[model samples]
Target: MSIWWSLHLRREAASVPLARRLLLGTMETAGVDPDISYDLSVALSEACANAVEHGGDTPDGTPQAYRVTAYLDGEKCHIEVTDSGPGFTAPHRAPRPASSDAEGGRGLCLISELADHVQIGNKPGRGGAVVSFDKILKWRKDAPLMAV
Candidate 1:
C-alpha cells in the first residue's frame, strides 16, 4: 500500500510542531518502527522551523506560506518541504557545517544526516528553496500496511 499527504501552512512558529505531530500520527498509524518515525519527525520539525523562520515575504509584502509533502511507497518514505524564501545561495552544494557558536544554520545538515538520501535545491522559475529527502522504511512487526 502507498500513502501520501500534503500541507499548505503559514510561516509561523506553531506550525512546526503541528507538522511534526501529523507526520508522527501517520507513521504510528502505518505501524512504522518508532525509531525511524522519531528520526523523520525530528527532520520534519527542523525543515518546518526553517521555513517559518526564513520563508520570505511576497513582492506585495505579504508573508509567504510554505508547503510540506510526504509519500510512503513500498519500502521507502519521501518528504519535501518548500518555501518562498530567497532560496539557497548555492543550491547544488551541500550545506556547510554550522559554526559551533551559531544558533542556527544546522537544520539542513541534520536532515541530510538523518535521511538515506537528500536533495536541497531551488524550485525553477518560482524562486524558492526545496528540501526533499528519502529514507528506507522499517515496518513494525505488526504493521497493518506493510509492503507486499
Candidate 2:
C-alpha cells in the first residue's frame, strides 16, 4: 500500500507540533511500529521547527508558510519540509554534534541520525530551503494495506 499527505502551514512556532502530531496519528492508525513512529515524529518536529524559524518572506513580504509532505509505501516512508527562505549558498558544513548545553543547531544532526537518507537544497525555482528524507518503514504483518 502507498499513502501520502501534505500540509501548508504558516511560519509559526505552534505549527511545528501540529505537523508532528498529524504524522504520528497517521502512523499509529496505519499500524506502524511505535519506535519507528516516534523516531519519525521527532525528526519531523525538527524539520518543522527549522521551517518556522527560517521561512523568511515572500517577494512582496507576504506572510510566509512552510510545507510538509509525508509518504508511506508499506516498505518505506518519505518526508519533506520546505521553507521560503534564502537557500544554502555553499554546502552546509556538517551540522556539529550539538553540545549538551546548547539550545540550537541540532535539528539537522538529529535528522541525519534518524533518517536513512536526506537531501537539503533549494526548492527548484522557488529559492528556498528544502529538506527531504526517507526512512524504511516496518509495518505489522496484519496491518491494513491502504493505497494512497
Most accurate candidate by TM-score: 1
Tell me the lDDT of model 2 at 39. 93
For 1-148, candidate 1 gives per-residue lDDT tens digits of 9999999999989899999999999999999999999999999998899888889897898879999999987698999999999887773677678999999989989998889999988889978888899999999989999887
> What tens digits encode model 2's per-residue C-alpha lDDT throughout 40-137?
99999999998888888877877599999999886889999998888788777656688999889899999999999988878779688999999998
Q: Candidate 1, which segments miss by more than 4 Å at Cα? A: none
What's the C-alpha lDDT at position 76 in model 2?
A: 85
Scored by CA lDDT, what does every candidate get? 0.91, 0.87
The best candidate by lDDT is 1
RMSD (Å) of each candidate, 1 decimal: 1.1, 2.4
